[model samples]
Target: MTAIELTGVTKRFGDVVALRDLDLAVEDGEVFGFLGPNGAGKSTTINLLLDFARPTEGRAEVLGMDAQRRSQEVRRRTGVLPEGFRTYDRLTGRQHVEFAIDSKEANNDPMDVLERVGIAEAADRKVGGYSKGMTQRLALGMAITGEPELLILDEPSTGLDPNGAREMRELVREERDRGATIFFSSHILEQVEAVCDRIGILRGGELVAEDSVSGLREAAGTAQTLEVTVSRADEELVASVRTVEGVSNVTASGDRLSVACDPDAKTRVLERIESEGVTVEDFSTEEASLEELFVSYTTDEQAASEQRGRTSDGKNSEGEDDERTESESESEEVRA
Candidate 1:
């Protein structure tokens, strides 16, 4: 069953469009990541899902309930850790969790949730003295204290260290394993790559791409990083290597050549280097990661959006033309 659904959701503020016909769905017990550049309306969409703001058009649903009409009920069953949310400065970490329990009318043990979030040791310290990472942990603990069926985390790992980030990812997985759906929003590609089962990338208030990490990488045609250390440094040989098809952005530092190339083309590169009589000392290829793929898509999407805006003469282009054509055909009468 789908836990969250947005159908053609649109929002505007005066002359600026925040979201334009955004459509998305997240299945139950799945970790869905919402990725986007700044000003792409990622937060706006989250606010709509949480019913903090009503959409100008379209509809949003959470847990099979209309988001705007049933906001109170939705809040009762969902946990939210919004970006830049501030906790009570005088309240200790434990107090924050306890407050959440009270606010949610849940009978959860505050200490247990604190310990689970690795903030038990800091439970007694006032939130004003807590570091950024500690505060994030406290927020997560509060969000999870009620064990809600769905969790919405916005930039949840922003202040975490490497270890803390890893723990956060594990916590998200654990929550999903326990039958909770997670909608995680972040600009950090690595975090999304590590935890998300599926991803939706927003650009200029539009969902430009939606797929699994691997699927996005495949769609972007990202290349692997191939590093090779050779015994002899030959300028001609390096030039030849650069000419090899599917190789991109080749850099040679002394005898080591770092080549970004399609992973499938590595064998051909190896054979060409071997035929050139260069003694290869060491070689390895790391697969194209989700980070690279995200960069490619976000960058391309931004560029494309800009191009469209620059070229548009305030009229519908091919996309709008196709839509108009389809609508006309759909509305036409059919003869027997």
Candidate 2:
């Protein structure tokens, strides 16, 4: 069974619709990254899963239980490390974990939990004196109190240094290895790309895309970078490559030229550079980064939606003439 599933889920706040008819699912035992910009209803979806808010239409299920009807049960089996997690200033790290353990009626030792999150030495230190990164680790410690079947992490790497961030990734894997499903949501694109097995991107309060990083990159149709090693690199050569029909970015460093262009244009790019008395030594292609894929999917989806809206609004008289001109220009560009 899927660890989490939402079917036709729609949420609204008064007159404002927060989520459309959304259908999403996270398979059991996989780390699923939830991504979106602000005001994208990511928090709203979390609230619905935890029953902090009710969906205006459709169903939400967590661990095979109704999110609204059996919320208590669902939460009991799920562990959450919320965004900007708070702690009592006067309490020690041990005390915080103890509280969480008691609240969950868990048998986990507070010190063991603290140790797992790399805060055992600071177990007795007042949280008021902790660094932001340490505090994040402590909160993550609390979330693992009962070895929950599902883990939901919201910006789990916030305030952590590179080392702590690395540790967080390890711990996430450890939990998954021990049979837990992780729902990781964060704006840290690289971290998400490194850790998540699959991801679902939310845009404008709807799920715009979902897949593994490579899969999404393919679906988004973003350009790949061709790093070509050449005998010589110069300004004239860079400028020549820039005018390639599908080329978007061209840069030179030492004897290498990094060209961002459509897959079909790679041969043309190399030929253009070679034509300029430059010997092509060696070259390699790199996939687009997660960050680039994010922008493309989000912006492209919005652009497509806007175009459909304009078309549906109708074009007549003078407007039709202008539309024809625009279409002709676009077609000519495509043909070129």
Candidate 3:
């Protein structure tokens, strides 16, 4: 079942287009990570999904219902830890959870939710004095009040320490195990990579890449670096390894040959080394990290735009300088 679907959805704020021709589908019972740099329209897409804003074109559906038409029903079944959520300063943390429970008409012990978020000790304390991390925990506690089937968490680990972030990921896993579909968004690639089943990357108001974690790594053309340690680095052996199919590049160190190749070629390369009568002392393979893959995709467009800007400035620099000189002369004449 599709938990959330957006088809040809476009949102604009007067002259500024926030999202354009966006299409996405999140399946049931999977944790989907929405990732992008700031101002990439992640929030706008979420707003459309929650019916907080109407799309200028196309439609958004949450839990198989039109988001705008069934906004109330959607809220009832969805728990949101919204980005930049503000809590009542005077209210106690326990009161916040209780309020959510009451609003959802859910029978839940507020303390349990508080404990789950690791804020039980501070539950009865007034929120006015809570730290930012504690306040984030309080908001999370409220989000889980009714065991909602769908959870939309935007930057859920904000202000959390390492331990707290780990705990949050654990809770995400727990919720997913309980059959909840979680749509999580964050700029922190490590956290998202840790918890997400599939990830979608948005760039310039469009869905740029969507796939499983490994699938994305593959799409990014990330290769595995294989280092084969031999008793002696042989030039002939290295040349043979380079000729193997899927092997992109090869370099030799003192006693190690580092080969960059497709992951599937690792075995073939290793087999060929033994075939060449070289004794393999040790070998190690390092695959591309998610962080590297993320930067490659997200920064490419930005880098291109910057290059274009530089080219335009270079072309007009002489003209701009001449205009500046003419303006200064005109100003001096007026003064005279």
Candidate 4:
């Protein structure tokens, strides 16, 4: 079941078009990452879904309700943390959470939400005195308090430290496991890569790519980087290791052998090293991260757009020249 659906949704502000024929679908109980660079219509699409901004054309539906006509009903069933969010500065953490629960008319205990977010100790502290990371945690506490069926998080990890970010990702997963569909928007590729089941990449108000991290990696033709460390380095062993199936490139540096290969080829490479009398002290693998994937898609899309712009410019120039020649011929006839 789809929790959200957008078909040919278009939104504009005066002359600036925010979304153009945007089509998106988010599955139930799945963590879907909405990815894009700054000004890529990620927030606009979210606004349309929330009915914060009405679309100029097309349709949007959330939880089987028309997004525009039944916005309040949709809002009641979904939780949202908008991009660069700020909470009530004067309110204590507990106060903020309890307020949200009251607004939602939810029966859940506020203490449980605060504890799950690791803010139980600071629950009585004013949010104005909280650190950026603490404030982010508080926002998340409120967003998840009502146990809404769908969570819409925008840049949820922006102010979080590494540990805080990890905890936030865990919370998202926990909610997903409990049957909530998470539609999160972020440019922080690492967190999204770690938590999201699938991703949609939007560029210049258009969604150009949508797939799993592995699917995008395959599409990008990305190779895995493997590093194996041992007690000692052996030149002959490195060369021999390159003979492993699917090992595309290999090099030796100090006590480690670095190999670039298919993601699934690491086990074979390690097995071959062991068979050849090489002792492995440590082995690690790194695939193309979401950062790499985002950059690859954005670069390709930018290049394609520039090429189309040049082609259009050339066509317009040719048409102008033809128009000038026709005008000159008409003037000559008048002179005759």
Candidate 5:
């Protein structure tokens, strides 16, 4: 079953487009991660799924129902830890959980939910006295009250310390094991990389990549750096290695040559080196990390924007300098 689907969805805030021609689907009984940098339309997509805002074009469906027309039904079957959720200052933690249960018409034990979230000891404390992490725990407890079929968490680890974050991830796994579809959203790649069954990366209001962690690593064209210590290294050997398909950035320093290429291309590079008559002594390969892969996919637009800004600034500075020179020339001519 499809837990959530967005087809050709576009959301415009006046002149600014938040999401554009976006298409995505999260299946039932899996943990899906929505990953992106800030202002990448992750929140806007969530809002559309919950009917907090309507899309300017296309459709959003949650649990096989139209998100806009059947929002109440969607909310009833879905548990959400919404971004920037707030608590009633005077209400106790237990009260918050009870409110959620009542709203869902669910027969959940408020104390049990508090215990599950590791906040049973503070169940009676007023929310105004709770620390940020404590409040986040209470909100999570509220979200899981009814054991909803689908869970949508937006930055669920926001205020958590390292240990608290680990605990939260464990709970996500538990929820998924209990036959609930989990949609986890975060800007932190490490957080979701561990728990997610599949991940979708959003950039410039579009879904740029979606796949398992290993699949994404491959699709991102992340390569391994192979460093070979040879009996001899020279310009000719380096040039030959560079000519091999998929091998790139080959550099020679003394008896060591460093070549950047995909894992599969490592053998081909070695063959080329041997063909060039350089005896290999030893070699080591360093694979690209997940963080590196994340940056590679998401930073292109940002880098381009920065480059454009620098070019514009340079042009404006040149123009100003030319104007000053022309003005000085005009003043000199008048004096003459």
Candidate 6:
């Protein structure tokens, strides 16, 4: 079943359009990555799902209900970590999570949630004293108060240290394993590349690409990085492998060779190496990274967004102001 679905969703703020004829779907029980540069309608799409704002045209559905019409019910089953949420400063971490549990009408032990987010020791500390990473963890703990079916996380790794970011990625996987659908958004391409089963990239308020990482590499005709551990690596082997069609670059070290080539050229690469009297002990092909694929698709649009940002009105071409205040209003809805 699809946990989230949007069809022909166009959101406009007066003369500026934040989204245009967008269509997206995230399957149940999968970690789906939502990617876009600043002002790419990423937040607009999130707002539409939670019914914080209505689409100017078309429809949005979450958990099988009309997002705009059944908003409260939808919010009840969904957990959100918005980009700029303001947590209560005077409250302790535990207090924050307990309040979320109460608001969600859930019977959860606050400490368990805190522990899951790696902030249990600081559970009693006032949020005002917490570091940015710790505060982010606290918000995440609160969002998981009810074991929500859908998790909408916007830049979840913000302020998290390397270790904290890694832990958050693991938590996302755990939640997905427990039957939750995660709509993860982050500028950290590695994090998205690691956790996402599939990705949808938004550009100029439209989804420019949506597919698995491998699918995207194929669609873009990007090269794969092939690492071959050979019994011997020599210039002869390197030069011979380079002669193979589609083999772009070859680098050799002690007993290993790194070859960048087209996916179909992999077999010929190996054959060339073996024919050159080198034993291919082991080999692996790594798909192009999500970052490379992302840049390939959105570089032009990003440049365009920058040019539009210079407009006298100060709104991003993608309508970053696209009613940014709506995000603040939606924060209240999420907290409620």
Best by lDDT: 5
lDDT of 5: 0.85
Candidate 6 has what TM-score? 0.71
TM-score ranking, high to low: 5, 2, 3, 1, 6, 4
Clash statistics: count for each candidate: 0, 0, 0, 0, 0, 1
Give the TM-scores of the predictions, in the order they appear: 0.73, 0.74, 0.74, 0.71, 0.75, 0.71
Candidate 4 least-lDDT 10 residues: 308-317
RMSD of 6: 14.1
Candidate 1 structure quality by residue, lDDT tens digits, 186-206: 998878888998999988898
Q: What is the lDDT of candidate 4?
A: 0.80
Candidate 6, residue 272: the lDDT equals: 71
Against the true structure, candidate 3 has what lDDT? 0.84
Judging by TM-score against the true structure, name the best candidate.
5
Error of 3 at 155 (Å): 0.5
Q: lDDT tens string, model 5, 13-131?
A: 99999999999999999899999999999999999999999999999999999999999999999999989978898999999999999999999999999998899999899999999
* lDDT values, one for every candidate: 0.81, 0.83, 0.84, 0.80, 0.85, 0.82
* lDDT tens digits by residue: candidate 3, 201-246: 9887889889998798776456777888987676666656655666
Local lDDT at 303 for model 5: 36
Those runs of model 3 whose alpha carbons end farther than 4 Å from true positions after fitting are: 221-287, 300-302, 305-336
Model 4, 28-50: lDDT tens per residue?
A: 98999998887889899989988
lDDT of 6 by residue, 138-170 (tens): 989988889899999999999999999999999
lDDT of 2 by residue, 83-116 (tens): 7558899999999999988878899999999999
| Predicted structure 3, TM vs. truth | 0.74
